[model samples]
Target: MKTDRIMWGIVLLFIGGVLLLENFNIIEFYWGRVWRFWPIFLIIGGVNILFTKNKSQIAGIISIAILVITLGILFYKGQQPRQKEVTISSHTEESNDLDIPRDVTYSHPYTDSASVKTILNISGGGTSFDLKGSTDSLIIADVQRKLGNFSLETNKTDSITSVSFKMKGKSKWNMGEGGNDVDLKLNANPIWEVHMNMGAGEVDFDLSGFKVREFNFDGGAAALNIKFGDLLPITDVNIKTGVADVKINVPVASGCRIKTKTGLSSKDFTGFTKLEEGLYESPNYKTAVKKIFVNLDGGLSNFEVKRY
Candidate 1:
């Protein structure tokens, strides 16, 4: 019995130290994803409590149990080292009598929406309806709330026309958009053309796995990324910005004509090549057998055009 007491005492001491470290911020804890393995610790401690007649032994066992369980949870979450992940805090609710809706089958133009107007926010999320095989809809999203982790996702298999989505914010997201506007980030796992306006956001768009055609980019105090290697049967492309960094990726087959402009600042085309010549520049220009054109403009910060 005495030996058992000493054994439990050592376990208790170790657990106590772990608790202290946690309190001092030496380790972080996450109660979000992993709470499944917890019962094992409690069960062990409980079993020890039922068999151990000595008070000290039971106490030690319980303390050690708690410590092991706590640390296991912290370590399994990948948050132990402290890294930032893109996460959003948003709500989706259905409300009828919403603004309005119109369908466009031809080139008539149409629109759709999802908004919670009473939430005291200048922020909202919704999808722009598209024609299964053609482009006909124009998007106009006006959100005016302080935002963090804003994202827009469009269906990958559908066809659409002229997407003019915009975001405005009142903060600095390492990406900029003065204040009072929507912020945009797009990642579509399908093939489609995109025209986006990120008022102030850290916008990263990836088409590396799909096809793309006619893309336009506009940023206001933000970062922009458009990879052309992901686009197929390319038709045209353009990029414009107010204040931020821009990165464009194209393929060598992209014989597309491109134009770039910058604000009261210097431009960076270290990403692009063969500027002294024209579209039919040379065999090295890698013209995209298909007819295509690309135009680019930027204001303040860095701009780039490189092959993906």
Candidate 2:
């Protein structure tokens, strides 16, 4: 059998097994956690291609076994009962290292002011998120939750700074309700790249007071409201969600264009001119000195865009 075919067969088998286990209540698999491991499949395919030639069925069988074992280990660990809840910090891969002493406020500043770029990665799994601009420091992150439920990670380099928020415990789908709550302030001086991955919650991002170069939001069954601030240094904004309701505000003076790709969803962009089926442009988009471009993709969602 061809290596590509063998690899795909193994992948299908693994997915089928996972679904079977899920059906039998033997394991509850979170695809988000396992999605990062996709690169391993490429490696497996490469190994199969190299070794499974000239009727070498042993190589293909070994490759399939390896994948099965890997997935088995993941499911086994996920099903283990922790002495306490397990929180995975975005800053580190080791989940057992989180030790939250009490229900206290935690703060971390950008250690070096010389860093020109800041990337804020907030994984607000089933939580409420509120973020705005701040001049108090390079970045200020504040998270409030039950003790031992969440943790923060900060990493700084000469050219970049990164901060992440991660949660612990059994997380359920957030359907417009509560989970981890976060309030963060970001410095205006450095170029900012903000990425949020959230689930079943509400997100309010008042970014009009900050200087942001790029922003990306990904959510699962959530509600998102964003207000753009003055001096948007970046031109591109991207958002993807599943079963979400979204509203966005763009500064009136900023020329803006919106392109939406969705499935069975509704959009209200009243003031903008529709250039095509799913593309829109502001009145001054061609003449304005600075412009904003937005791209959205999702399914069964509500989207609205307004000029403020």
Compare the candidates by TM-score and give the number of the best one: 2
**Predicted model with the maximum lDDT:** 2
Candidate 1 residue spans exceeding 4 A from truth: 1-191, 270-283, 286-292
TM-score between model 2 and native: 0.63
lDDT of 1 by residue, 35-90 (tens): 22334445655656665655575565565566556655545662343233322224
- At residue 190, candidate 1 shows an lDDT of 30
lDDT of 2 by residue, 1-308 (tens): 57567667766566556545654568764443333343565787776777666477677677777767876765665454323233333433333433321223456654455337788787756556677557456655565443236667878776787777666563535321124456767776767788877666667888887667788988776668888765853467898987566788989888999999987666778799999988999999998887888898977666788999
Instruction: Report the poorest 10 consecutive residues by lDDT, candidate 1.
Output: 114-123
* Model 2 bad stretches (over 4 Å): 1-102, 111-115, 132-135, 146-148, 172-178
**Can you give the lDDT of residue 292 in candidate 2?**
84
TM-scores vs. true structure, each candidate: 0.41, 0.63
Q: What count of clashes does model 2 give?
A: 3
